[model samples]
Target chain A: MLRRAASILAISALVLLVAGMGISAQADVIVIGEIAALTGPTAQQGLQERNGAVLAVEEINAAGGVLGKQIKLITYDFKGQPAEGVSVYRKLVQQDKAVVIVGTNFSNVNLAMAPVAEQLKVPVLSNAMEPAVTTPEPGKVNKYHFLAQPSSIEQGAIVARYALDELKFKTAACLVNKGNSFATSQAEAFRDYFNANGGKVLDYIEVPAGAVDFKAQLTKIKASNPDCIYIPQYAQEAGLQVKQARELGITAVVLGANTLGVPPFVEAAGSNAIVAGTYFINNVHFGDPRLADFMARYEKRYGEPVITTNVFFGYDNVYIIKAAIEKAGVAEPEAIRTALENTKDVKILQGAGTITLDPNTHRPVDMPAWIFKWEADGTTVPMTLMYP
Target chain B: MLFQQIVNGISVGSMYALLAVGFSLVYNILGIANFSHGAMIALGAFFSYWIARYLAVPVPVAILASIAFTGLSSALVELVTLRILRKRGQGSLYFFIASLTVFNLVTAVLVYISRGNIVSYPRAFLSGTFTIGNLYIPWIDAGMLLISIVCLAVLSYVMFKTRFGLAVRAASFSIKAAQLMGMDIDAIIQGVFFVSGTLAGVTGALLGVKYAVYPYIGNFVYMALFACVVGGLGNLTGAVLGGLLIGLLETLVSAYISSAISPALTFAFLVVILLLRPQGLAGRATEEKI
Candidate 1:
């Protein structure tokens, strides 16, 4: 009976913690719920996403939040674990009564939670471009599950065009980190698009996430003498890869995913390791006055100015959600979903162009991509706009 | 290509050797596997980087100061936590848990402080490269190999040639016997922790220069404890051999075979080696008294 009592107490405490911590989901206040990775190995990402969300939310609240009902953002940090994401989302939907759920960052969690969302009949949108998240059964696509950002197929096609046509590189080699859904899909997209666009891929290598050395990988690629190298990896592996590749004297005009434009990448490739000819999928331009103003405000809030496709999507996700809620004129779950489906030509504070979420694949249309270069002083400056 | 990979392996092997020596010294003498020893090493590694780059101190001064700082911290760790646990008459498992908690706490703090940003600093001591037989080995690699040898020699002298060293070994092997023989257990243990922590600091410095401090990257360092165990638990010389063997196997597997296969390969090798040579490579066999 003592043991059973202890178990009951423990369960009660857990339930309390979950409910108490859950952001308020009420009809009077339009509460938008987000499940993001706020801690763990990819903890830096949380800072960006959270801050961007704050800036967007703050702007909305300052100018009357969601048609005079203050938009309350209730976030549950997943800490980059699937189990945590699942638990957090369950509480967020059931306990918090969250009308709509945004993301848990990585596609794996979103894909896993898709069924749960469908069961609950809540609209689920994620920033990750993983194909499996959208079309889970390969053929059967769920109408409830939607993706706000361009899918990997669309993003990869733009990146490939930037590499082959705009840059005019005849031969390119791609190095992708193995076991990563994002890396694998982006690599496949790059390979497919490059081959289709009459460009040759010299070698495609998949290294692990925790690999410390890239000298051997660079040596083999160097021997192939590819003029351009494309690496699609997260900031962690890509940081070391960028540094080690330079240290080994492989200074080929390199192209990377949006991850290359982040802090870990700049901090890792400091002093001499930062190669000048490096280009990445840069959505934020330092030259544009409006982007500059947004960056200044972002810097004032976040203390460092770094923007990515993910953060832009994250910051923009709020306004679009707000727009949808306002259009619906009610805080109903189905109404919000319908409102989101109809959102068009909406200007998100963090993006260069207006993002329009296409209702079919649930991806944004006309999401432009750019090629940015790293300076010797460790600043990632916008080099050129590659594809729009 | 082969030579380069070997040089790369040996260079990294020096790190393993340094870490191995630190682990061996503490475990053999303290009768406790200070799991915080990895975080201690990482903490030491970044201390110098913080001084040299972050605080604008000279590299040499930063290196020496950080080593001493880590040593002091290690000693305080012993005084505040380990010593209290020891006084409770519990086994080393007590220290093990305390040390593990301390490591986790320190790592959590480090993550909180650095916010997971990988920081790098230039060391003037190791800044260039030399080419031999189509392999360009960084000067830092050669420096690590040299320092590793020098530290081993110094540790050997302290263990075999010094009176305090004898007391430490005696206290660990047979605490009652050593106490009856009038050895200063506290003094000896303190000395051992200091030496162990100092070596960890040096290893940490090498790490900061080699690879920028990534949060919780020493996770693999704890995994090296298995190497130490397979080397015969708490045997100093065996720990060294185990580290070298693990390092060589890691390099070879990554080069010749697939990198993914090495985790299984190393585990299987260790299990097989333990089965064949239960006493470990350089472990001493005990005599039967009953």
Candidate 2:
């Protein structure tokens, strides 16, 4: 009778174990697809966006994941190409069945991915700061679309203010790449403010990108005798201009957009001659004493100091996702989106910077743009803290 | 002041001549464009950058190694991408397509391997400014000019004086014919690729050391393409002249008209030349020889 009772207990335990395993398997992990120009021209930008997303996901998982299950972030390569970005987004939605997506660092690529996201009704958190991403028809845009970064208009206006108030330049020359959204928007903002502020407009030079040299623009800038030259271009082309300008003895403040803060621009331009300052709406400021802990953890993992906001963006993004998941209290997309929208003051990377959401703007609450200058020793130093 | 722009043109032109000559040699000898030529260029720079970052070699030694690495990579390309596909019945179309795919794959593989970080040379290589007259010559530009002349002179001597070089010339003319004569055809062909690849590598290294190295940077070789076109595709002398001329043209455009139209000027020149004289600057047309 004891032997029979023991056998019954063992079989019952086995059944119970199997049933528990079956129930756990039923709670499926929701796939979150991320597409970025992980490689190609403008690669650094893509890298930052991808890094930010990756870090966010990791933090999300570390903080008990989303819903009762862990998120599966499926990343795809679009190589900064519009068509490729579209295809990648489609694949993520149709084949991968990713509940939500974020991607495409380039404005054009982001715009391309927008239609696909709208058609599929998948909430897309675009990292592209292009003005068009928010306003599709200049006024009409999708309600579900969200952007982590502020618009190019804000970036342009901030830069314009810096050039006028801070730099105190009389005449400024503008080197605008006629092809890109960042260049065009910044150029517009600079024009509106600089001229209105009683500064002489030297020359509005439109340079076609990848044209090898910028001697003509330099010559024009030289002739105009501008106190400064505003370049709303990335580091690759921007480096060439700064180098060429200095080469021609045209000593003027060469200002650039936030993209200029990257290492390639500094390396390309060299140190002493080409001085540049840029604004970034980053969550983590390098000078933040609160970031000391985050930095320690980051350095411990990567074996290097996190100087730029690139790594911080990734690290904080992870926490943002974590907060959203916690708010949702479930892994469901609708619940997660609500949680993300409701996320406020949930600090992970920096002990500061509240992640507040306003229903009117449909972006994070009161993003701050900080200025950083490349130091003599090849280190990016925090210059000014700003709210835009 | 205008003189300064001209000098700038010459410096950049030298770089193109450096790149175009190697490309022209590969095209002439192999009877194939060797589209993966960019890989050799990039690798040369990659090697130089690595040397600067890790070993901290002087620029001169780095240049030499860049050439050798590029040459070896070129030979490797032939081994992996060309040799198997080469057949009597088959033309260069097979090699061309295979290598185009090879080019894309190599680029993809390189990027995947590096995770697309911009690998740059140490700043010490090209930091100071050397002033000659009113013109301020940057150390980097000065270094590029010196390197170009040294490589070009050495290449000339090798091609004219050395027996290995003669074999190379023979192989390029007609591989079968050269084989029929007393010559090791395979060795000659391999040597051509190696030599040509080395030249491209040197150019790439120079570019990386002086400027910066991200992935696929060789695509920005503006002067090389124009030089190739102007030099009649496979002519060495023509390549040099073409590179220098285009370099000057670009500088002039940048100095006077607009820097934005410099690339457009190159294409416009190509179109005009093609329409008027498709045979090229020094390219011969032998239709109905008397």
Candidate 3:
């Protein structure tokens, strides 16, 4: 009798929960889906991305949200897995009824989601740097997928050119993380550009993923004596590499992707003194006068200073969706995707001036990358903006 | 460059040795791989970090305190899980699975506590490198080598010279026989766990200093397991030799050959070694005791 009564209560509670969810899914609000690595190795960046998106949504709704409706964000943790990303994408689109999806700076995850986005017909605006995320083959594009930042090819070539032309580096070594598509794509581009353009690449070393020790590899690189080292790894590995390189007395100028500017890199390196003077290609110029307000607002909201360029990626992604919705003149997935394809001069944070996605490839065209030098005090000084 | 790589290998090998010895200790007694040693390693790191950060203790003092704490935690784990299983006359297979589950649970709890964020020590413990000739050796690596040697020496002294060590050895030879001879079986097992946990704590605290502190730092236990297998499952000296060999092989392979395939090549080499000597490098073939 007691068990029967408990079962009835449990059934009624579940019914009430479902009913509550149904009521919250109002027609008055436009639902947007976001996928991020919210609870895994990359959770730090994912949380920053989520926070940025939430902040943008809050501000957008305050100014009377797009298409005469308030914005509703439904975020799911991808847990840094590509398969999980696909399932979450499906859940958000099919169950949550989202008009657009934003997120995930991880290239592999975005690559996995590209085909699913095409089939679902829901536009995805991502910060993943790999060009293959949007364009699977040369001259072929995934119409539903869009990239916010410049692709890996462009960023890689830009850094290579900066090293060769501006820094006058005659020799370089490339240390790549073989498992990460983001790192490999950049390293390949850098190597191709550097070798073709009067710079000799001494050695190209590929390390396994999640490796902490680089002393042996660094020892080999030291023998070759390169003018600079191009390390295209995530923040953790990059930090360790730089630290180990410095310890081994390899004083070559270390260059890396945007991950170098994050707090994790500095923390992993152990000391600012170790990372000082290292150059990196960054997405956002933190020193920009324009970003001052956003920085202040972010710190106030999160109770911590902005750690990575992911914050801007997350913030701009929501605004990009808002622009698409406003351009399409409707809160619908198909309409928003088409509008996103034709997106032009949308005023958003990150990069210079405004964002414009090329209709042909669905990637930002002629997006310039910011080059910064790490300071001894653990801050980055903006040096120059390079265009590829 | 070859000499420098060798130095690097030895430094790396010493770290593996520290972890492998701890793993070997539990295996020596129970004959079941105590995978919870991994959890103790992670706990050692986290406990030291918390003590140093929140309690504002000196890093050395914090490490020492964490070692004791982890030791007690390991004994408590045995008291709860292995002790009860022994009482029920359960097989070692159940204990093995229970240990792996404990490792996962601890890692998950740590992940929740840390929010999956990788953190460094609050202050620099052993920062910077001092070069001997053209070969650069970081103070942390040198310090770790010294500490590892001291730990092993102390462990050896305890294992061979002490009364408890006699009991442990006798138990390892035959637990049933040791019990018949009026030895306290449970106490010996608990003691072994405490000692193993202490070794894990030392390795964890040092590893956190060398690298960064993260919940997944416990993954180093895989290397420990590998070292134990290569060194001869029940032999202490073999565990140490196996660790050094693996480290040296990894370093030399990465330095001379391809870095990407180094792990594959190292494991392949290990497989070849195993095939040649089925009893392992230091292990002697013995009849299975029923």
Candidate 4:
């Protein structure tokens, strides 16, 4: 009879322990994950992303939380590598139990994470400009990844149009980093658009990544005597190319992708004069009245002035996730994925208009790419906003 | 256009020559690749940049000071890591690994300090290009070429003419024989390291001016390794020849062929050459005395 009593006690304890585990697992907190290159060559942009997301989460949490549950952000540093990016995506989903994910400015990393997102049944909102991150093949969607910024396709054509219609450049030469899919996609898009629009693309040069010296390629471009040179690369290479181009006496108008507008590009160029008259296609519209408040709050929170467009991306992506979660009305991964697909008319701090993802492509639609010209004082002045 | 490309090649090749020769120096004596040489290169650049920017010293003086400091640091690295390992009777592989560890540790520290930002000099020096007929050459490239030639000449004189050079050469033949002849092996090894470090330092400073200063700027050591291997790993003259050839090939290939595949093509070419002459271009096969 005593042995039977002890057995009953052990069974009751096991049942209570299982019930407690379930209760704790269903605690009143919503988990979200952010993956970024927090410590690598692109850390500057990553730092901005982290700061922006942190600010958004704080504001949301202070405003009585989202769906009556305090939002908890789990951030992972991929260190700018695609392999690490995949590993972190798994950790965020499987380990952190996050319902929705955001971040990664690198196109390659985003591309690597898309398939994993689909398998994990989690939705990823990325700022990576590569169109392939959402649509891996033409007319085929990845069903999980969403892009918050204008794709490289739109930005490239906008740049080409601005060059030909606004600046009236007759001939151009394209220089791209072959190693970077982001750069190559933009370069190729520009080449296609320029050629289709009756502009002469004198030569398309694919430069190996990390080739600090560009005199050899610049000499060939100079010999060709094009009226303009299109450089689509990240800030480090962009600054070096412009500085070297000016040194080599290539007086052609310089056109670049969005990455060229960052402070690192200016810092890398050394003097503002070298970058003066150079224009790059960007999504940020500094003159937009909505940004004044955002900029002020960002500075107050981070103790540093805004330097890159990535800050906007970080802030906007979090709002995108929040909107999806509210629409879903439940902190479940599958429900959030479904809700994210139906997102429409969401407001965010980027582009010249509201953020809306195309239901079919999972990419931002009708977003305008603005042309920004570098001033003599190391500031970028917005010239005109163009839409695809 | 051809002349201009050739000029560009020479400018690029000269930088590689400085690095390869310095890299070959330690290898000739120690029979091991000193990977820390890359860190010394990065340290040299950062040192010059910091002095020139923060202290407001003249660029030339900054370069000299950086050269001295980096040389001493290189010697110190040898004294601490390799010297200790050698005293412990470690194999060549341990020395190589320890050198690599030093390189990685230094790079990581630089990354932490700089926060992964690429910085240029506060004031432009050797910037802008001057035209000679139809050929346009950036002043920085011209300066690098001139400095590299002068350094090579001085190094050649020291290695061929000086008593210290005699000891190094003797030690290279046989460390045991040199010791029996009353040579201090430790001192000779340290001296070689100092000389090698000085070369790496100047190269680093020039490279920083030409490009931008970043933690990963030391990756140029790959070019040095390639040149050393192609020219016969321990032959100084071979290193210079190999550097110029590789530089010229890279320039011409990128100019005429697809830049995307130029590096791959260059590596393939190196492989073919290596297969043809396993001892490399200038290496002489020497039998062990047993």
TM-score top scorer: 3
On DockQ, the leading prediction is: 3
Q: Candidate 4 residues B3-117, lDDT tens each?
A: 8889878888888888999999998998888999999999988999999999999888898999999999999999999999989988889989999998999899999888888
Q: Is the docking of candidate 3 incorrect, acceptable, medium or high quality?
A: medium
> DockQ order of candidates, best first?
3, 4, 2, 1
Candidate 3 lDDT over residue span B1-290, tens digit each: 99899999999999999999999999888888899999999999999999999999888999999999999989988998999998998998889899999999999999998888778888888888998899999999999999999999999999999999999899888999999999988999999999999999999999988888889999999999999889888788888988898999999999998899999999999999999987778887744431
Q: What C-alpha lDDT values do all the predictions have?
A: 0.73, 0.70, 0.91, 0.88
Tens digit per residue, CA lDDT, model 1, A1-388:
9999999999999988876665443556766778877776566677577777778889899998777787778888887777777788888788777788887558677777877777887787678777667677655665566676666666667777887777788888888777677778888898999988899898887665566666556656766888788887877567667766665556578888877877667656544346566777755565677766777888888777655545565687787788788889887789888877777887765345677876665666767666677777666777666543
Q: What TM-score does candidate 3 get on C-alpha atoms?
A: 0.96
Off by over 4 Å in 3: A1-25, B287-290
**iRMSD of all candidate structures:** 2.7, 2.8, 0.9, 1.2
User: Per-residue lDDT of A1-388 in model 3, one digit per residue for the tens?
Assistant: 9999999999999998997788576788999999988897668888888899999999999999988899999999998789999999999998788989998889999999999998989889998889899899999999899999988998889999999999999999999999999999999999999999999999999998878999999999999999999998988889889999998999999999988888888888888999998999987887789999999999999998888787898899999899999999999989999999988999987888688999988999888889999999877898898888
User: How well does candidate 4 score on lDDT at residue A228?
Assistant: 93
Q: Kindly report the root-mean-square deviation of model 3 from the true structure over all alpha carbons.
A: 2.4
Predicted complex 1: DockQ: 0.31
Candidate 1 CA-lDDT value:
0.73
How does candidate 4 score on lDDT?
A: 0.88
Question: How well does candidate 1 score on lDDT at residue A252?
Answer: 78
Per-residue lDDT tens digits for candidate 4, residues A201-234, read 9989998877887877888898999999999999
